[model samples]
Target chain A: MAENPTPTPARPRDAAIGTGLGRVLLLVYGIFALSASARALVQISSHFSEAPLAYLLSGFAGLVYIAATVGLAIGGERGRILALVSCSIELLGVLVVGTLSIADAVAFPDDTVWSHYGSGYGYVPLVLPFIGLWWLWRNRPRP
Target chain B: MNGPLSLATIVVALVLGVWYVIRCALNKAPSNTDLWSMLGLGLLVVVLVVVAIVGLFGPDRPADWTTFVGYLITTIAFAPVGVYLARLEPTRWGLLILAVAALTLPVLVLRLQQIAEVTSG
Candidate 1:
């Protein structure tokens, strides 16, 4: 197979953060960003009182996803910091929320993106953060 | 929202998704044929969405019509977005992106079907 040479100029090492596999990651992150935010919007608008805590968490998750997506899209030192922070928060949120949702069902009357390790969304939420972090780590500037 | 149409779309997407995954594993970029097949699947989704919109005006309409319409829009745009992103990255990962999009379509369709099933009118 002939090598598919990339025509884009190779400069600003940070550009690598949004190419190749990173682009695939961007697509997944974008999907999550849209779905999470939209879900939160619908939930909050239609029935905020039903599960305020869960709904708020849903909104927070949506913002985190949006931040991560933007960070990946931007792809530079600033973007890396943004992505790193959000991914860390996401990882913590999923683990904490997942465990709490299982241990104390009463508190979580309704589900958020992180609830039950995102079983409702096929656990993609649980796994996405790890992937995001790995991608960030892989793209980190070398000494 | 026709059962047969949804089933066909799901099957096609799953098949294409599998093929894309295999190609990615083999380190192959998305070929024109792959992209065209995805566009064809996108066309099928559009038909399905149009049928769903027509169904909304029929006797039985979804109780949460707004959410149903939202899913319809998302479902219809999914394939083209996948194709566009895949075009940007011409590598094995592009195939993976296509695979993800194809696989996600079935889930979206299933959700649409679920919403359609719960009728208020």
Candidate 2:
């Protein structure tokens, strides 16, 4: 068989969603996933009754972060949808929970990742979803 | 966890983190020297984690020993993970990844120190 002389040109724009800058985002998301889930595990296992709502929220946030990380890692049409959903939920979660935690402090005796708009985490939790959404938008599949 | 060692690690990591960020901004991929420096930082982190682990055997132990151990594991693994990801990337973003990892180390180290200070023994 004769070899083709012309090779396919690389298309940076159409590269896998998890490459380049996406990989950097993946690392940050991975860290958050690990930390949030671990924190939830520790809190729920050690003293679930003390702050049931907060602990559950922590677990929920952890799941969201994990989903986002997986979505970024997968990086395709399906991955985009997954990341979009998770990031939206994260943004909403942070805002609603932040407000509730501040407005009704008694209900949230403990801090979740979103409490006080993630002030406890240097507000990274609050900022992360925005960045995730922006990245997703940037990597949207073109027609 | 020795205070001086933690301080040194944090200082070095922060300095390297800044440098990596600058390199990334300049659109530079991670050079061999850059990767090697990260490994060197990783070695420093390994030593820090080892000391912390050995501290666990001493009379005084962190009140939240489980969390401390978890952070120690994460801290030790962080640098190698950064290096691996950066190698796979081979782009400016790779340096940014290293920067993120480098910056996060100080936070982990500080948390470790805070946990260690609250010894129950």
Candidate 3:
């Protein structure tokens, strides 16, 4: 409305989330959730037999994304833990799968979300976990 | 998906992306004006999506029209979703939300173009 600006308030170490950085985190997570699921749907429905491993990885990626989204949206101590666990698993999954997809191309005839460290998606899958972890650390609750 | 409409939508979205990125870097809270501009962009996207809908009925329908239609829903709803989140956040992150949406629009538009190219009528 007015040019008047609201001084950015310090967020609760825990109470409310998705206000500042959490909002951006949510947006990114939302994007991943949508894209992973959409891509899996396309691959599995069209030609699952062509590359079952890759397509299944896509679906697994989608599930993790959904878990992360719910965890972030819930926003609490346990919520943060859920988000942390999911994001950490995501990081490891992407790295391991990403390396496998690249190092052993024959094993992956098709691509997953983490294929080649998510080069297809601008390396966002690779980068997202670090951001997620950072967000959680920043919002660590004061018990 | 194949007309001046989609092209314009991409160009305008990129421009808005640059604007939002700059705002985020500067740590500015999203202004009402920013929201209005986003709404304007949303209107443009609506126009492009509607045109694609009309194209769907025409003689050259894309194969797997279902996915294309699904993307159309995502594309049309994207900006308004960003605006709603941005409004709730009211900070630099809000600007970042706009930036993300603007960046995403081009991807969706490009996907629409690809799907439209594989026609079955």
lDDT of each: 0.91, 0.90, 0.87
lDDT per residue for candidate 2 within B1-121, as digits (tens), equals: 7999999999999999999999999999899999999999999999999999999999999999888998999999999999998887788998999999999999999989989999999
TM-score of 1: 0.92
* Candidate 2 stretches greater than 4 Å from native: A1-17
For model 2 the TM-score comes to: 0.91
Give the poorly placed runs of model 1, Cα more than 4 Å off: A1-12, A15-17
lDDT of 1 by residue, A37-123 (tens): 999999999999999999999999999999998886776788888888999999999999999999999999998989999998899
DockQ of 2: 0.59
Measured against the true structure, the TM-scores of the candidates, in listed sequence, are: 0.92, 0.91, 0.87
Error of 1 at B11 (Å): 1.3
| Candidate 3 residue lDDT tens string, A13-110 | 45325367776778889899999999899889988999998899899999999888878777676778788889999999989998998899999998
Model 1 residue A130 CA deviation (Å) reads 0.6
Give the 10-residue window scoring lowest on summed lDDT in candidate 3 chain B. B1-10
- Chain B, per-candidate TM-score: 0.99, 0.99, 0.97
The worst-scoring run of ten residues by lDDT in candidate 3 chain A lies at: A10-19
For model 1 the local lDDT of residue A10 reads 46
